[model samples]
Target: MENPTFSIQDIPPTLLCYAVAELDFSTLSPNLTNSTLQSLKSCGANQLAGLLSSFTTITSETLVSLGSLAVGLSPSVLENINGSILKENLQSLSTINNWSATQASIIVSKCKVQSDKQINADTLKQLGSLVIGVQSAEIKTLKSDDILSLANNSILTGYMEKAPIVLKKQFVQGIIQATSKTKKTIFQVVPAELASEIPVSNLLDSNLNVSEINQMKWTSSQVLPITNQAQCKSYFTRVGQANIDLLPQGSPKRNTLLSNAKSCLNINSNIITKDNLVILGSLVCDLTDKEIISSDSYVLDALKICSSFTDSQKVAIVTKLKAQYGAPSKWTLSNMKQIGSLSSALDSEIMKTINKSVMIKFFPGLLSVLRVQHKTTFTSVITQLKNSSRIAARDSLTCEEKLTTDSITKQMDLIVARYSAAQLNICTSNETLLNNLNILGSLAFDDDQLKVFKGILDMRLPGGVPNEYLIQLGNIARVYSEKEIRSWNITSVDTLATLIQSASWQSNDSKINEMVYRYLQLNSPNATFDGTLLTVLAPYICSLNQTLIQNITSGALRNSSQSLEVSTCNQNIKNILFDKMKLGYSSVNSTSNAYFQIMSPVIGGARFSDLINFGKGFPEMDLSTFTTLNPNEVKTLSVENIKDLLGSNVLDINTISSSSVLQVWVASKTQMEVNSLGVNATAGIKSPVPNGVTSGVGVPHCTLYLLLVCIMASLLYMDNDFL
Candidate 1:
């Protein structure tokens, strides 16, 4: 399937024609060789035309040679030649001057000028001579003058008789300078059978004035015919809004125009008007509830005066006004005052649309309205506000409504006076109960309300109690007795801790704390104090039994005590351990069994020996569990404290010697003390190595002498002189 290749120098004339025929002219080289010229010069007019198909540029030399070969133009060759090349070389082609109308039409039709450049006068005249079968598309590029010139030869008249309606419109409209007399002649020449097929748009005829257009015989039958609805819409759009009123009322154009104006309601308010709305209401007998509500305010105002709208239409309009201007959550005291100006039925209908949740939220403002207006029916409205879906009356409280807390309490008091404990309990959600527990207790609930509250707590516990609910529940613990607190099986240690914290918010802090402490001891006797619980109990330790505080705090650290040891805790309790428990060491004495209480603060943070002093014991512990002490603590120890502990034999030497960290401490303490005493360690003092200790990890020799001399001297001078 490969095409045969031929070079320009060796290609024979017949073979060149074959190659030219096989290839697209656009793909061929523009360059020409002497052999190509000779080959083309000897070829017939048909072959010369075929070679020209492949040449991108036609030199005068090439054109002159090709023109000499034109004994006659083959119709087939002219058909294959490009139209642009033919037009450019038309003057040289003398045979076309003698051609018949059919031959000239064939040649001109093949000339391919792809641009929008119009044909000049010469081409028009040449084509005009052969106008018998001329096409509209072929001559579409002719100028207005050239087209008018065709009329002079009667060629345009002939073409219009056969051309389609679209071409006829384009051709006639393109001649902006053509006279009405010429247009009338063109129209007169159009086939009578196709006269009615011309649209009204074509007759808006720049050729005629307004008066002439009106006087035309076909103005109604041809231009404004009452046909289908679509054509009527088009006819009306052409007539425009200013002239639409001139049309007959019963006509299809008028009816369609009115229907479209009525149905097209814009969301924008600025574009709509009262007059337009009146016209719209005339066409649409009934508007939907949403449509009436969503329309502009001007439309609503117009509907009110129109008297054609029904009562439902008025209700829908008021509903939208309430939703926008008086929405329950967003409405303020000012809007509540405006309600007094409204009619009784409209005011009641507006209030009825508000659901229970929203009614509760806006209750304070509405209550203020009722009080100011002296409306006794407000009581019934309040009753209607209490629906099953509303969680609690307090939840509807909008604090931003500028109502005082006292005002809220007064309103709540009036509402709760009529309801029994059972009715209030049914509507209250647990969250509402917890959030307003303090207010609930202050409400002075009768015996039945107290019983209902106890039942709710029981119900809340059977499912696992969320921490927030437990904290709030503990706030109202003063309402119940010790027996009741003990009856509730308080499980999670964390919840027990939260109960102790919540007592501070109640009426009697000490009484509630004691009750909760006793309840914790009785129900969950095995509960241990982690950091959180230990912190909650620390402040009350001075008031409660000392043994209980001791059991909670020291029991975790003492090996003999069986309480659980707390190693990790939240940051709040950890901070409390360091700041509060550490400061509590002022109460420590040799007689107490609270040894771990003294050490608990140091174990939580910082070094053990950093907080350590002379009196506190160097408590024995497993060496493997004690690795977190800071290495720098060894250098900061006082010489007097080191000797006091060493002479007292309080720490086991064997256990200290076994630890690498402790060995460093012992060597560092001895070396530092010797330097502080003003002794030269190279000659005066000897290093001591304990049994079971490594020798190589001793203190460095380069440690400066006279360390802490000023500190030691100041302390000794004060003790001797003042004490």
Candidate 2:
């Protein structure tokens, strides 16, 4: 009666999704509720309602509880599956996920017998009994005989339709026999329906020791906006009109102070257009939200810019962006997304030649390009950029390729060189003078980047609670604290960490992020630094490979939290962790587990990995790599459903040995090299004899462990802080 192959074609995907959703209900209630049964009864007892009523065995409430085996679940989605006979039919599907030959045969035999019998009262009662027996057996169904052991536990309980029951010897013994592991009886078996509801999330914020409501309580009228949790997504947006400032009327000095404040805040002139909206953005300080009736795009962008800002400087740029780009949504994808395609989404609109330090800090990349390319002249590869507006005036040549046009480089004649930024009459609000600075300082930075950065730190943050006491945090920054950033290469690991941690955007809590970002920024390869710095940074380069050093540390640490944060804070970190771990990591047992646990409620990500791949390194988590999904696939796979599947797989992957017989497909990514053997290299010995086992168990091999320490030392030669 058993079939070798099985398909879930017995039910429609929609119906299946609905069944799972319904079982995942608010409470357990077997009795048919009037809300649904009424609709079915309207169709009469012997009709669709009658047939559906018979399916009471598989209510959505029951099925969604076995969440993993099924997909998405909704309330009342299983009105038809509330009956005893139907519930068994639903449980049978779990066989597909956890299928084995014997279980499959048992299922097939049951189905075959049911099909051969008549569909009357006696048959229905028999089927109900069988379904109850299946529930009792489910307790012992998991691998490692763990479920078997759980089933045998006195604490275990089961159900027959609406009633709960204890397992009998017949079903309990059969499951124990089928289970494979003796000592490995792992997790107690959760009935299939219960697993569906506790969908694990990939991104977890372990930092929060409490709930959101409790966290938000601190940000009330009593606390400063800095202490208040700023919405990380749109901290700069002026939610309503009051948050935005119009010109304040006062005496000349009052006007001057307000003007200076506006300039600092980046408030632009009041030019309310039909399409564009000019508002302040990127400040971490709080603002009250008011209604904006505009349905246009530019205004929305201005709103976004204002909202995106948190720092005082960001407020100024937001003012300028609104003054300049608040025209209309001439292009699609919104101004923010469009501009992001070219530069970062946050463009403070404030520029500074007078403040070269700020310019370099703000636009390091553009500064880097300018440093190498400025006086050195590059011809316009795409000669039309200078005449872009003219050509656009004639005809807007908006194409995918045109939109993505990169910086046009080519040979050019002697260009007028000046460190002064372009005076782009941007976001000045009723000011006495012109603010003429934009990115020119970044160009001149190669000559004075670090000096300017150091000056800025000395000015803004000042010697304080953390950094002033360098021995504590300065130590964290140097050495192989996390990834590739070694000790010698860094000038001030504490300074860098302080910068990122102290970022206004992360004003809601104690600053750990400030430390993270500063480390990454200075670590940029383009910026020239003393050779000793690199020697210290990639210390493994001296003799031991960096990857090997990381490997030794990770193995000793075991996928601990220390390995997690440093492993992902920078691309360099990922490179080292992945490479060292990948050297010979059995595909079946590979783990992407690790994270840096910070001690704050608010933390801006210095490492790129935190946001996109938050909980991935926390044990067993695998994320969706789908660039796009077709409508058909989307229909079958809702976000909730996909999330469920992903959550289960992520948690389970760790348990499943990475060294499985099956081939794993870890993405090909950059990694630090561990050991390289050239084809031409000679092996000193022709053959080496292997000892069958450790000749002596208790014997201490000081030499072997010493070699391991040596290897680790070689890899982290620059790990002064770690040492």
Candidate 3:
């Protein structure tokens, strides 16, 4: 056994087994190579059993020498290993994340036996990921002091991340008890990972010092557990202004916090004062319709920007303003400026009443927040204003001054914004407007408008639309007929990328696919699609036929940077992409946290069984993807998963209901559990979708359309109505 030239490969299996049995454990341990371990594993189970039997006592060194071969060891053999040996070697042992539950449990049991059945910080740290194998009852037995001692350590946090809901609750209860007595609050003592586990009851502690709470950093997940009227009141009162200011505008946390705060505060608008409104700040957005109507105009004026007001709330404020000022027609420029962003709430009728001077002054702020329907009306108002001014100026100015390039450009913008397909005759007759037809890209044309606009564009670019003109067309390119798009000479991937990325095709699948197909056939006819090209074409990749999608290389899919956009693709496309993704990101355990991190964007396409395989990484799924999950599949998610998921949005009811999967999942939980999950049992549910918007396959299509138009308008005509 001590031969200097000896190699495991040189020895016969039978002889090597006997030699391994006879060798000193310490001497052989250090010399064991991965090759030597594989050779040992290949020796057949019976032979290895004979070899293991020869050792009277197995030490940590002996197990370390086994390396991956430990995975091959039977439970009976593992159980026979001494607890002291297991305890000392737990750190090394736990590195193998693929261990079977039975195998890991045996290690935990042996470690506990050595430490008097109580898991302390040192032992817990040593267990590493094997803590996932620790049963719910064992987790319940975790002492408060032990958890507190490891407050700064990641061991408990790591365990809570992957542990089942039932186990996490038990562990969280221990944490609640552990932090209750300390001068520091739970926010001060608990690791951020375990922050979501704290219940609303614990969070609503009346004894909490506001100054102390304000000083601590709060994550959206940490605040998500406060859902009900009682919790919102207690939580908001405790959180202080500093922490509240930390929430981002239009975020789910801020929305839900204000919603619940308004309900709980139950402010009386009839008697509310200016100072009270100032103190309420963003919470004023939550004031009921009746309350808004009753509130004094001067007091309402004290409030500034309302980042996200519901359509009904906006109407109520407008109604109150009209009552105070008579009608918008009678209101002066001073009145329009006084209302600030409330100007966005004004209806078409009210807008028509507004004179040219007041609207020009107010348009900047109003344009940013105008509702979709109001945009068309506002465009007509601009047209009327422009026409009246032109008539007055025409009598005083010569044709040379009236038809100047700047004046014609301004007129082109007005016509594009105001004219319908029938009214487009004026533009067709004007050579100057036809030359600046790229301005048409600022608006989304219907089929009739597209026909008229296309005729004008064809007349302007009779040589056939080249790459430069196509790029300038912006979203207008999306409306081109398939024959017109296919006729374009696409010479560079950059040109294709720019047009595809810039243009947002609403439901024009055929047109988008035509553009994509033409680009592939012309620019990349023989080339294998790389990450750069794949990402560039991501917007319309779903339109690719099955064969083309399946042909996309695994390496390209792994390296592609358009995962967020790709996640929005149809199920068939995603399924194909995910197949290639799996090949690129192969894992021994597909459910591990590492796998989830690499595969999260496309993982939504995974089968229900594969999705349920997720361990600690379950919460990493994005909200949009999380919503598409089967309700029954969501029901099977671990409690810790649900908490972490809900906690991501800070337990906002509106946020939760936005995902029907979460709504159904929340409905199945007990009232007590629901409160613990972060929403109140009594809070009313509201649609997450805004007014005059529709979603397709969990995506907010109308919202996206408006966003694209705004972007295009900003790039083309900075002062267009779409803005």
Candidate 4:
């Protein structure tokens, strides 16, 4: 039925009579509010009585929430309210056999205006009885004069005892709820005529097992009908916002979310009973700071939901699933061969984007996963769940009853297989890179991990990160032609230099700049990192590492020292530096490659570069006109040219019987320093001064940058050789 329409003049007769009778004193109950009695007493008993006699009625629903001030008044105040000459509805009070003195007074003051004045007086004399008849049985009725005083005294006692205060609370809450409901309905129609008609109890009856409802009647508690979609959405949004705010940052909610995302690769359908929305929601909530909103993480999760779950589970989950892709079952390694592109438009979540790099490294493991694991797919499960929800709209399940591990792993496997190697490596290693590798990426790589990343570039999972891990790592290295290492998280010079050195050593001449670019990108050569830090990077460009690689490749780097005792041809370079120029460089005459030795002699670190880069393109040299090539005029040459021009042979003066460029012998001085050119490296130590630049130029301006620029035009010479 529709609502009954009414105007002011159309008020119901019952409502009118009830309203007028309310003004009469008959409406007063035996239990008067002391607060009300006190308030009206202040207005005098005659006026208060008259107001009560003419009291009107209202709808029971509206009136159910009303209360009075009787509990707040003293006995004297109640007496004053009764004695004041304003009441008229007490005429029928004479028949009372038993009543409280308070009830008698209430009746008389209410009926005093009766046409039969005699009956009115008589009733006032005996007033009592008939008070909701079933409850109040033993009280004696009181007479006219005594009734007023007794009622007033009772009212005072109520105020003192705080008995009537309880009654007022119910009245106010009822009024507030009714008024709000009425207002809400005034603008919007409530389809159900009454509370009993709501389907809430039907939807949540015993089988739902939703115990422990919050008893408060806040607006949120209202069982809003589904008919109002806007209200329903508003309610859910409010709930979601509250949940996010309540969870603090960095808590479990924030931590390890990345790892959880990775686990999606191995998730199986055995546990896909839970809603797919949980994964979607977590992706949204946890990806707080990662800049990419529609990131790789989001897409992967959405795919997992759409593809991995079992048919039954799928029907129950994936709420608000805008994507219509069908679920798949029995994922096999062969399925891996099907998807050409790794990215699918599933859900665009943030964690997926920021950590896409780390996820790339796990392909081998994931490939291994595909070869041996599991039966059901996430698609079957999610599909089953969605179907269930569609059939049972209001039915919801508990979280644990929702998802378990066996189920979650099936979902993750699809993600692992679908992701690209570069992207996955980064995402997979996010934890390691962000916290460990990234921080020390610039630190000195004396540590074993850095060494592993540089050389091992690709290896077993437990080993250090590889170049391919950071998306930008290989790009900056400029070593596109070389086989890529996997640790891109190496932001530190030590790690980057290690990567640089490893790539440079194994790298072809063309690929050197690529390696250099990557190293510079990580180390930021122009960015002013620490000097000690820069020292670590120096070796990546030029290193004693070559001696070992040459051995590894030719069965030479691993040889014993005796095995390396220079042959007639090998010693020319070795003996030249050893006997002629006498410049100390770390030396090992081919001992077992594992057992290495270093030179303790006072040779500056930079001299090693001249020795290493001599012929292998450390900046090739092929100068044409030494006389015509002025220092002011520069010409560019390949790293190979510079090396050909600067080899030990060029520095090897046959008459002098020396193949080394120049000597750096030790002085008796205890300090380690530079000695201009020929003296001990320790001959030029300076005292500490405010903001000083060390006057050390071990590297030639032509070694990397200048060398490439001028290799074709200038002769390779030491500072002393220039003299």
TM-score per candidate, chains pooled: 0.20, 0.21, 0.55, 0.15
How far out, in Å, is residue 421 in model 1? 4.6
Residues 367-457, model 2: lDDT tens digits: 2343344322111211212233223323223321110011111111100111101111121111111011111111222223223332332
- Indicate whether candidate 1 or candidate 4 has the larger lDDT: 1
Measured with C-alpha atoms, the lDDT of residue 455 in candidate 1 is 70
Quote the positional error of residue 538 for candidate 3 in Å. 2.9
Best by TM-score: 3
Cα lDDT for residue 216, model 3? 40
Q: RMSD in angstroms, all models?
A: 42.8, 30.3, 21.2, 41.9
In angstroms, the error of model 4 at 643 is 67
C-alpha lDDT score of every prediction, in listed order: 0.44, 0.28, 0.58, 0.29
lDDT of 3 by residue, 1-723 (tens): 448787556777556654543332224443454335555666655344324432334657667767655655544356568988888877778775555554666677667777764556666666776766565566566677777776666654665566645556667677778877776667677666665576667776735554444434344345545344444444454433433435655676667766655555675345555544555555665566666776666545643445445567767888888887778777777887777766645555556566755654555445434424345434543554344444443323233232235543444433332345545544344465355545555544455656766677777778888676777676667667788888887665567766776655653266766766677778664444655567666556766667677778876665454553454466777677777778776632465443554566666566555665664434345455567655666665655665554344443444555566666766666555556666544322333565656645433344554887546644665444356
Question: Model 4, poorest ten-residue lDDT window?
Answer: 593-602
lDDT rank order: 3, 1, 4, 2
Candidate 2 vs. true structure, TM-score: 0.21
